[model samples]
Target: MENLQMLMYGFTVALSLENISAAIFGAVLGLIVGALPGIGSLAGVALLLPLTYKFNPTTAIIMLGSLYYANMFGGAFSAILINIPGDGPAVMTTLDGFPMAQKGRPGQALFTSNIASFIGGLIGMFIVIFTGPSLARLGLNFGPVEMAALLLLAMTSIGWLLGENPIKGIVTTAMGMLIATMGMDAVRGVPRYYFGSIYLMGGVPFVPLVIGMVGFSRVIGLMTDRKSAPPITERLHYRDCMLTAHDFKRLLMPSIRAGLIGTFIGILPGAGATTAAFVCYAFEKRFKSEEPLGTGAIEGIAACESGNNAAAAGAFAPLLALGIPGSGTGAVLLGGLMMWGLNPGPLLFTNHPDFAWGLLASLFLANLITLAISWVVIPILVQVLTVPIALMIPVIMTICVVGSYSVTNSMYGVLIMFIAGIIGYIMTELKYPTSTLVLAVVLSPIFETDLRRAFLISGGSPAIFFQKPISCVLMIAFFIFLALPIIKAMWKRMRSSKGGV
Candidate 1:
């Protein structure tokens, strides 16, 4: 009941004209960013981040949140129409969405995905509203030992899930930790990797590095691909571009199931929207649909779209309640919170009710805004995909350079960002997941801080991690997730050897 009252007050703040405008603007911008290929939410948010440093923290968060959710909403447009994923989460949308589009029902695919996205997002918000307080309550008991164990779990999952091989993931994670060790130590006020240079005092600038790695590197990679995606166009009447009453009836249950699935997976640290989408689609595949999946089935689109959108919402749970991010974009948002002088976690709800509740309330409104605009602008959104990638790359590249420069008032920042972009491109070429590196970078400081604190509290006893029940559970989970891959590999090798003998 108290949570309800707080949320009601949050709605008042969110409905204010200024915040509403921010939400609308973010939703529109996010949709545009999501529709652009290779410039996923991570880059989109990073590119726009420097602009928010000047805004009030609440307004800044509102805008960023709007962009994040709206990007998920807009991602389906290109996925359904052009068969290219607009964002990572949209990959599954292509399986069935594009098939539907190819069957001359482009509008139907768009409408189904838009509707599913809306429902999924709503489900995500409710899941947060219900679970956040409980989690926050539990998080209140998390001391250094507990938090350190949990951080380990998060880092392990990020590496294991983001790529095919865990070894590459661990290598990137280690590299990120090494990079993070650069700059002055927060506790000692002394440089670890500055090498007598004053400029390295601040360590690495996150926004600049992320902008280079995600936005700039993506642009550089596309510069070589050279080939354009399929052109998409449609003659539209209002009816053709909208979901029919019958279609809604067919989709309602599937979207709901996916919403739940997405919310569950999304709340787990290091799991992501892409994973949620795939999981839900696979889960739902056991049911009979009007059309077989991967064959233009609306049911498949519903499951994928809803799951991803819901997962986006679910990702916020760990981020808000534990100050732990589940995905690359979640890490970026976590970084934003720190920059704004706001700490995420259980205390945030008490210390910064306005930021927490206002952001939550704004998310609800952002969904409506995204859905309404998406339906009205389906034709316009579809046309965006047809813009030559050749033309878009240079323009996006210029923006990224400018965005990176704005992060630090130095040309040196630009140089570092460009170098990071090269590293990102190389990582891509070698099939080493860049996300693991970003995940490692994001978690390094937190993990170090908490582990040091735990050691201090435990009088230098490493067994402190196993002493607490919660920490023991987390540590066990961490080890299991970490060791399962190696175990499976060994089992496979043994079986192969036995067969050869």
Candidate 2:
């Protein structure tokens, strides 16, 4: 009841003319930026952050919050229409979304993504409202040891599930880890694999690498196969995009499950929407989908999209209650908070109830606003699938180059994009899963940093992982996942031997 009263007060603040206008503007701008590959929420929020400096803290945060929340909705636009992902979390969306588009149901795919994202974000917002401080406290328990163990399980389990050939998956996963290690050592601050280039000192930039691996590689494919037809040759109207009753049923359960799980994952330190999406998709793979994942299954799309959006919403718990950024974008928001002279911590809600609750209220408003905007815009966005390959190649190439160069304002990022594109194309030909490699690149650094910190805290003793309850549980799960294939293989061999005898 107290929470409800506070929320009503927050509504009063959020619904004011200035705040509502800011929310709408942020939601619209976020959609445009998120639909563009490589320019994700972090960059989008950071770029717009300075403009909010002169505004009141409440109004400033409401706009940025809306932008960040709406970005999750807009990311699926590109991932579903083209093969490219608009942001990191949308990487999982591309696995099923692109395939669904190819299967001549681009409209339905977009509908599923948007609806699932809405459901997920709604669930996350409710959870955050009721359990914000408690959830943040739970996240505090995930120290270095626990985080390392959890990441290990996620990497190994998801990597194994990604590819048909387990050996190839392991090899590619290792390859990504190697590439991630090229920059300065996380603990010692010494360059390990610079190979004589000063640019390697900073390591490979993630935005360029992702754009090259996922987006530019498609451009390369289009250039090589100029005669290939567009994915959607027929005209698609808004009416054609409506989901069937059965499709909604297929989407609902997964969205609900992922929303619940993703919210919790979001509250964990450094386990952002991308990781939540990957973990939720992997979890969904254990269930029976109407169609195989990566082949345009609705379940696959629902799980990852919902998971990412929910994680985006739940990320606010840690930021508001603990002053700890749950993701890179959250870090940017934290900076904005400090800059506005509003300290975010235990006293935030007590000291500035209006600012704290208004931001939360703005998220709910943004979720609805973004959903309405996406529904209106999707019909136009899906028309991109009908464009000729010849025209798309140059346009996509320009996006790749601009997105990459924009990250660092250097040609070095563009160079990395081209190199990664070549490698991604070759890997595609060789049938190696680029997704596995990209996931590894994203998670390995976190794993390495946490592992080193854990070890340092424990005087290099391996038992430190088992000493903590959370780390022990995660480590156990990791070993179980690692050994499951071997156990199954041995069981099969034993059964075959008995039959032969």
Candidate 3:
């Protein structure tokens, strides 16, 4: 009852015309950004962050958060219509989304993604409402050891979970950790890897690095291919494309399962929507053999779409309640909070209930607004694919250069972006998992700072990690994640041996 009242209060703040309009604008912008090739929600937010500096804290959050969440839905249009992922999380959507669109049911594919996104976002939001306070209390009990162990768990889980080649994932993750260590050592007051260069003083700038790796690098790839995306010629009415009662009944369970899976993954630090989407897709593929995946199956769309959006909403919990970012985008958002003169963590709710609640409330409204925006503009979004890849390269590259400089108005940022773009291109050519690298870069500072604090507190005793209950559990999970592959490999060998006998 109390939670309901508080939610209503939040609605009051979120329902204002200015806030609603901001959300609408954000929704449209997010769709265009998501529908664009070589860009993702993270870059979209970073590119637009400078513009939002003028708004009040709540309104700024409403707009930025809306854009972030709405991008999840927007990415599906391209994935379905053109077989290109507009955002990292939408990569899995191509497996089934494009297949569905090619079957002359593009409208259905778009509807599935949007409806699943809405349901997933709603489920994730309620989970946040009920668990945010308790999670905040839990955060208070986590010390440096626990935090270090948590970061380790996230790093290992992502690397192990994503690719068939765990070594490749680990290598990329290690590269990220190394790159993150280049800046000054705050604890020791010495430069660790800067080599006395002023450009390296703050380490690799995150915005430029991410924009280059995910956005600029991909732009180069598309240009190299020199092939135009297939145009969508479907002109079906929205009603024909909308979900029927039977379709809802069919998708209900998958939506719930994916919602839960995504929310749980999102709550874990360093996990993100891309991970969540893939996890759900793989799970459904493995267990629901009755319905084969990657064949334009509605179940496949439901699982991936719901999982990604749910993870986006779920990623917010750790950021809001614990001052910890659950994903790369969450890390960017933490910076936004600081920029707005607001500190994240448990005190945020107590100190500024209105701001926190208002943000939450806006998320609810934003999802609905996204649905409306998607229905209206999906036709235009489909036409975007027909634009020549040759034309987009220069435009996206220019945006990347400008965005890199905007990070700090420094030529160094642009240089870093260019270098990162080259590295990103090479990494892609080598089949390295760049997402793992992104996660590591985002996590390394927290891992180093906390591990150092733990060492200082424990007088260099490594046993301090085992002394804490949460840390011990996390350490055990880390070891388990590491062992799973070996165990599976051994089991496979045994099965082969038995079969040969």
Candidate 4:
């Protein structure tokens, strides 16, 4: 009841003319920023942080918070309409979203993504409202050992994403891990695999690599196959894009399940929306889907989209309660809070209840605002599928170059993008799973850092992972996943031998 009263007080502050206007502006701008490939929420928030210097801290945070929250909604637009993801978390969205769009239900796919994001954000906000500080404390229990074990478990999901060829999948996964290793060592801060180039010392930039591997590679395909027809030829009306009752039923359960799972993942230190999305989608694979994942299944889209959005909301728990940044964007927001002279630790709620709660309240308003805007624009965004391959090639290629270049304002990012694009194209021709490789790249650095830290904490002893309760449980889960495929193979062989006898 007290929490409810505080929230109601927050609503009053958030509903004020200046605060509400800031939120609306932020929501509109966030969608545009998020829809543009490579300019993710981190960059978006960072770039805009300076502009909020003059506003009252409460209104300023409300605006930036709204932008961060709405970015999750906008990310799905490009992932569904094109094969490109507008942000890291949206990468999983492309697996089902683009395929579904190709199957001629682009509008429905967009609608599904929007609705799932809304549901996930709602659940995450409620959790944050009631259990924010406690959840932040829970996250503190994940030390280096536990984090390493958790990442190991996440890496095991690569096997599931590898498609039909285990060998190729393993190879690609190894390649991704190798690529991830090129940067400076996490613990020692020493550069490895740079091969004498100063640019290589920084390793590969993620935005360029992802844009290259996913977006630019598709551009290469379009350039090669210019004669291919567009995915959709018929006119699509808003009515046609609306979800049916049966579709909603399919979307609801997965969204709810992912919401719960994603919120928990988001609360864990350093496990952000991308990991949440990957984990949720992988978890969804364990269940039966109407259509198989990666082939336009509604369940796949709902799980990932919902997971990412919920994780976005859940990320705020640590930020508000403990001043710990759960993700890169959170780090930027942390900086912003400091710049505004607002301390963001345990005393924040007590010291500045209006600022803290108003930011929380604005998320609810932003969620609704973003959803409404997405619904209005889905019909228009779906038209991208109707554009000719000949025309889309150059356009997408431009986006890839601009997006990659924007990362560091250098040719190095663009160069890396081109090389990764070529490699991605070849990987496609060779039937290697690019998704597995991308996932490996995303997770390996975190895994390596935590694993090394765990070893250091244990004085190079491997037993450190088993010493901690949480780490032990996670390590056990990892080993079980590692053994499952071998066990299944052995069982099949035994059955065959018995039949022969």
TM-score for each prediction?
0.97, 0.63, 0.87, 0.62
Best by lDDT: 1
How much lDDT does candidate 2 score? 0.80
Q: What is the C-alpha RMSD of each candidate to the true structure, in Å?
A: 1.7, 7.5, 3.7, 7.7
Q: Name the TM-score of candidate 4.
A: 0.62
lDDT of 4 by residue, 33-104 (tens): 677554466656644554566579889888898898888888887787767676789999999998998898
lDDT of 3 by residue, 232-351 (tens): 565556675777787677677787888889988888776789999999988877656334788888888888999999999988888788777766567667767766788777777778
lDDT value for candidate 4? 0.78
**Model number with the top TM-score:** 1
- Candidate 2 deviant stretches above 4 angstroms: 1-117, 128-133, 165-170, 222-363, 485-501
lDDT tens per residue, model 1, 1-501: 877787898899899888898888888889988987767888888888887877788888898999999999888888887778888999999999989988988889888999999999999999988788778889999998998999889988888888777767777878888888889786677779988877777788888888888878898888875476666555555678777788898788889999999999999998899999999999989999999999999899999999999999998888988988889898888888888888898898889888899998898999899999888777777777778888888898888788888878888789878999999989888888887777778788888889899999889998999988999999999889889878877888899999999
Higher-lDDT candidate among 1 and 2? 1
* Candidate 2 TM-score to native: 0.63
Candidate 2 per-residue C-alpha lDDT over 1-501 given as tens digits, one digit per residue, 9 for 90 to 100:
788788889999999999999999888878876775555666566556555655798998998998998888878877887777778899999999989988989889988999999999999999999888565455566778877887677666655554455446566768888998998998898998999899998888766776787667757866765665535445567886899999999999999999999998887655689889999999999999999999999999999999999999888886787565566577567756765788676567778889988889889999999889888877665554355667757876887887778765899989998998899888867877666666677667767998999999999999999998888988998788678756765788899999999
Off by over 4 Å in 1: 235-237, 489-501
